[model samples]
Target: AYPILAKHNIKPDYVLALERHDLVYQCFEQDNQEFDKDILFIIASVAHKSVIDTLEKTKKSYILVHRPLPFSKALHMDDYGYLGSGLSVANMAYDLAIKLGHKNIILIGQDLAYDENGNSHPKEYLHTQESENDRKEGLFITAYGGNGKVETNQWWILFKESLEYSIDTNSVTTYNATEGGARIEGSIEKPFKELCENLLRENKPLFEKPQTLSEKEIQDKKDKIDECLKRVVILGRSYINECEILKSDLARCLENLNFENQDFNPLSQRIYQMKAKFEDEEFKNYFLDLIRSIFFHFEYKIAQNYTKNPTNIEEEYAKRKEYIEIHINWIDFIIPHIKLQIQSIEKGLS
Candidate 1:
C-alpha cells in the first residue's frame, strides 16, 4: 500500500501509526521510499518498547500520543500528547486527526474487519494467525463499498462503534476511502481518487506547524500531575484498607459456614465508593484505564459466575471464597504498582 501510494505521488499530511504499526516504517525503509519529512507520524506513547526501539533505530521523526490513565490526566497535545477513549490504535489516530483540527478527514486502509481472503491487515504488516475462535462468525456489517456483507468480531465492532461515536460527536466531516473492509457509520464512503480530486483545489497547506505548550500551560500540567499522584497515594491506601476489611469478613463467613446469610453489602459499598471517587470529573481525564484494568477482571469473574448459575451450595461457597481471595490478591498486586507509579511521578516532578 505504501509503495502504491508513493507511486501515485500521494503524500498524506500525517501518518497516524499506532503501536506496532512501526512495521509501516520498515516497509518504507526497505522500499527506499522517501516521503515528505513534514508528514507527521503520531504514535501511541504506550506502544511496545520494540516499536519505540525500531523507530529510534530508523531515526524517524514522530510524536508520542498519550492516552488517559487512572493515575494521570490526558496530556494536552500542545505538549505533544493525545488522548483516546478506545483501545484500538485506529481510534487513537482518529482522535489525533481531530486534535490536529482536520475538519475533513479521509480514512484509508482502516479495514476494521477481515477482507474476503481473511486478511486482517495489509500483507506488509505483521500477521498473527487467527485462532478458531477469532475466525468464528459474529456480527455482519456492510462492506466498505456496500457490495457484500463482511464478518466482524466483537473487538472490531467496538472499534467501529468508537469511530462512529467520535464522528457523530465531533464537528469533523469523515470519509471512508478504503474501498474495502467493514463500514463505519457516520462516515461517508468515497473513492480515494474522487476524494483527492475534491481536495486538489484547496490552497491550504497539507500540514500545520506542531502545537507546543506555553510556559504557563506546561506548569499547569505539572501541577495537575502532582495533584493526581497525591490522590493516587490516598486512593491506594484506602483500597488496601478496604481489601483487608473484606478479607476479614470473608474469613469470618467461611468459619461460621454462613455463606447463605453472608452479607457482601459492606464490601460492595466500599467498592461503589471507590468507583464514585475515581469517576469524579476532576479525575475523569486521568488514569481511567488503570482503574478499569484493576476492576474489570474481577467484575468479569462475578458476571461469569452469575451467568453459569452455580447450583451446589458448597461449590457456591467455594466460589465466593475464591472471589474474595482474588480481590485480596488483586489489591496486593496493585498496591505496589500504585506506589511505584507515585514514585515515578514524584521523580519526574523533581
Candidate 2:
C-alpha cells in the first residue's frame, strides 16, 4: 500500500503496523521495496526484532509503540507512542486519527473479502497467496450492496466485526467508501467519489504532521523497556520452578493412582499454591497473551471434572491418573517454552 501510494505521488504521513511476527519483515523483503522512506512506520514494540533491524538498515522512518496491555498498565504513555487495538493496524490508525482530532473517519479499501482473484490480502503477501485453499476453507458473508455474498476467511471476518464494534462505540462517524466487498455493519457505505464530491474541497493544509520525539524521550523509553524485560525474566524463572514443583507433586500422587487416597492433599495443595503464584497482578498483566496461548492448547476434555458415577475405585483411580498425566505433560511442555520466551526477550534486550 505504501509503495502504491508512493507510485501515485501520495505519501501518507504515517503507516501503522501491529504485527508482532516476522511476516511484517517478510512483506517488506518480498515486495513493497520502493516504499516512501519518509512515511513514518509506527510499529508495535513487541514486533519481531528483525523488523526493527530491517527498517533501520533500509533507513525507513519508524518508531516503536506500546501494545496497550503491559505498557498501559505499567509504563507511562509518554514513554512510547500508544498503539492500541489487536485486530488490525487499520484499527490502530483509528486511534491515531482520533488523536489528530478528526471527528469524521473515512475508510477506503476495507473490503474484508476476497478480490475477483480470491486473494484476501495483496498479491505480494505470500501468507495469503493460496487463494484456492482459502476459498475452500473460508466462509461467505453478505456483500456491501446486500445483493450478493463475498467469500472471506475467519481472520478478515474478525477484522470486520472489530471495526463494527469500534464504530458503534466511538463518538466519530465512519464512512465506508470501499463501494464493494463485505459490508461493515455500523459504517455509512457511501461511494468514494460521491463523498469526495460533497465533503472535499481544494484543501489548504488542513493538518500538520505530528512532531517526532527528542533523543531524551527515546532514551527514557529504552530504559523503561530494559527494566521491564529484566523483571519478566525473573518472573518467568520463578513460574517455571513453580510448574516443576506442581508436576513433581502430581507425579507422587499418580504413583498411588487414587484421588481419594495417599498424597492427594499434597497434590491438591500444590495445585492451589500455583493459583496464588500465577494470580500475581503484575505477572498476569505482563504475560496475559502468553497465558491465553497456553490455555488455548489445553486438552480440556481429559482434564474435565471426574468421571460421573464411576463403577468402582479402580475406574475412578484410572480417570484420576489420566488427568494428572495430562497436567504433568502440559507442565513439561510449558517449562521449556517459558525458558525460550525468556531467552528470546533476553536477546532483544542485548
Candidate 3:
C-alpha cells in the first residue's frame, strides 16, 4: 500500500504495527519504498529491534506505544495508552482510530481470508516463504454474504474474531465495505460504493499534531527507562544459569537410572522438579512466554507422532529425555533474544 499509494501522491496519516516477530523487518525492504517523513508510524514498544532499525535507516518519524498485554509488566510506556486488542494489527488500527477521536469508520480490503487463487496475504507484508506455504492448504469457510463460502484458514478465522470483539465493545458506528470475504459480526454490512456516496467529502480535514511529553517528563521517562533496562539485563542472565542447573541434574539422573524393573518413579519426580523452574514467578515476569511457546511446539510435535503402545520402557525414557532437552534448548534460544529486546528498547527511546 505504501509504494502504490505513494506513486499516486496518496498518503495515510498514520500506520500501525504490533508484530513482535524478528522477520517483520523485511517488509520495509520490499519495493524499496522511501516512506514519507510526514507519515506517523505507531510502533509497538515490544516490536523487534530490526523493525525499528529499518524505520531509523529510512529516517521515518514514529511514536513508540505499548500494549497492556504483558507489556505493563515488561516495559514502562504507559502514557501512550494501551492501544492493542484482538492480537492483530487491524485491531490496533481500530483502537488508534478511536483514540484519535474518530466516531465513524469504513472497512475495505479487510478480507481476512484467502482469495479464490489461494493467496492468504497481501504482497506488501508477506513475512516469509514458509508462511506463504503455510497459508495455502486449500481450505474454505462461510463468506460475507452468507450465501456461499470462501477459501480461508485458521488464522483468518482468528483475525475476524478479534475484530468482531473490538467492534462489539467500542462506542462507534462501523460500516463493513469489504466487497468480498469473511463476515465480521457487529458490523453493518454495506456496499463500498454506497457507503462512499454518503460519507465522502470534497475537502480534506486538518489533523492536529498529538501532544507529547514535556521536557521534564521526557527526562523522567529516560531515567526510568535506563533503570528498567539495567534491571532486565541483569535478570535475563539468570536464565542461562538456570538452564545449566537443569542440564546437570538431568545428566546425573540419566547416568545411574535403571530401566530393568519397569520402575520410573524416581525419574518422574526429577522431571517434575525440572519443570518447576520454568514456572518461577520472577522468570515468568520476563521470559516465560517465549519459554512456554517453544516448549509447547516441541510437545505438539511429540504428541503428533506418538504411538499408542511403545515397544518398551526405553522408549518412554527417550520421550522424557526429549521433553527435558526441549526446556534446556528453549532457555538457550530465548536469552539472546532477551538481549535483543533490551537493545530495541534503547534504540526506540533514542
Candidate 4:
C-alpha cells in the first residue's frame, strides 16, 4: 500500500496513527522504504508505559496527539492540537483533520465493520488466534455499499455512529475511500485509486503543517486551565462531602428498613439528582478522565441497585447498603488523589 501510494506521488500531509494500534509500529518498520521524508506522523497517546517508551525512542518526525482531557488540554494544546472526545481513533483523526482546517479530506482503511474474510482489523494487526466458532458467532451487519453482510460488534456499532455524527455535524467535505465496511453516512464513497487519480490531476495540497499558538493565545489558555482547575477542585471536595452525607443517610434508612411499607423513591430521586450534576458538559471537560470514570462507575452502580422499584424491599436494601458503603469508600480513596492532581496542575502552571 505504501509503495503504491509512493508510486503515484500521493503524499498525505499527515498520518494520524493511534498508539494503541500495533500497525503504527509495523508501518514505520516495514514501510519505511516507501515513506516520504516530509510526511508527519501524529500518534495518539496510549496508557501502556512500554508503548510510550517505544514511541519516545522512535526516530520518526512525529507529534503525540491527545484527546481534550483536562491535563492534555492544559499542557499540549499549543504544541499538539486537541482531538475532541470521540469514541474511536478514526473519529479522533477525523476531528484532528477538521481542527487542522482540512476542508477536503479522504478517509482510507476506515472499515468500521469486519471484512468479508471475518477479520476484525487489517491483515497487519490480526496476530491474535481467532477460532472459526468465534467468527461464526460475530454479529452480521449490512455492508457499507448495501450489497452484502459484514461482521460487526456493539463497540464497532458505536464507532460507526460516532463517525457518522462527526461527518454529519462538520462542514468538511469527506470522501470515504474504503472499499468495504459499514457505511458511514454523510460521506461520499469513492475508490481509493480514483480519488488519488483525481487528486493528482488537481495537484491538491495533501499536507499542511500545524501552526503554533501566539504568546497571547498561550497565556490565555493557561489562564483558562488555572480557572478550571480551581473550579474542579472545589467541585470535587463538595461532591465528597455530599457523598458522605448521603452514605450516612442511606445507612440510617437501611437500619429502619420496613418490608411492607418500604419506599425508597425519595432516596432514589436524590441519588439521581446528584448523578445528573456529573453529567454536565463543563464537569466532563474539566475533570480528569480517571476521576470522571470513578464517578461514573459509582453512579452506574447506584442506578443499577437503587433506581428501579424493587420486588423485595429488604433484599434490595441489603444490596443498596453494600453499594453505598462501597461508594463512600471509593470517594474517600479518590478525593485525596483529586486534590493532589489539582496541586500538580497548579504547580505546573506556576
Q: Top model by TM-score, which number?
A: 2
> Per-residue alpha-carbon lDDT of model 3 for 50-95, expressed as tens digits?
9899888777777777776653555556655687765778888888
Model 4 ranges with Cα > 4 A deviation: 1-12, 19-36, 45-52, 70-81, 126-137, 205-288, 304-323, 329-350
**Alpha-carbon RMSD of each model:** 5.3, 3.3, 5.0, 5.9
Q: Across residues 10-113, which tens digit of lDDT does each residue of candidate 4 receive?
A: 77666555546544454444344335567666666643344345445554566666766665664435555566467776787788878768787888787767
On lDDT, the stronger of 2 and 3 is 2
lDDT of 4 at 226: 72
Q: How many backbone clashes are present in model 4? A: 2
Candidate numbers sorted by lDDT from highest down: 2, 3, 4, 1
Clashes of each: 7, 0, 0, 2
Instruction: Provide the overall lDDT of each model, using Cα atoms, as 2-decimal numbers.
Output: 0.65, 0.73, 0.68, 0.66
Clashing pairs in 3: none
Candidate 1 colliding pairs: 69-286, 69-287, 69-288, 70-287, 70-288, 71-287, 72-286
- Of candidates 4 and 1, the better by TM-score: 1
Assess candidate 2 and give its lDDT: 0.73
Give the alpha carbon lDDT tens digit for every residue of 234-268 in model 1: 65566556656656665675566564533655654
My TM-score estimates for the predictions, one after another, are 0.69, 0.85, 0.75, 0.65
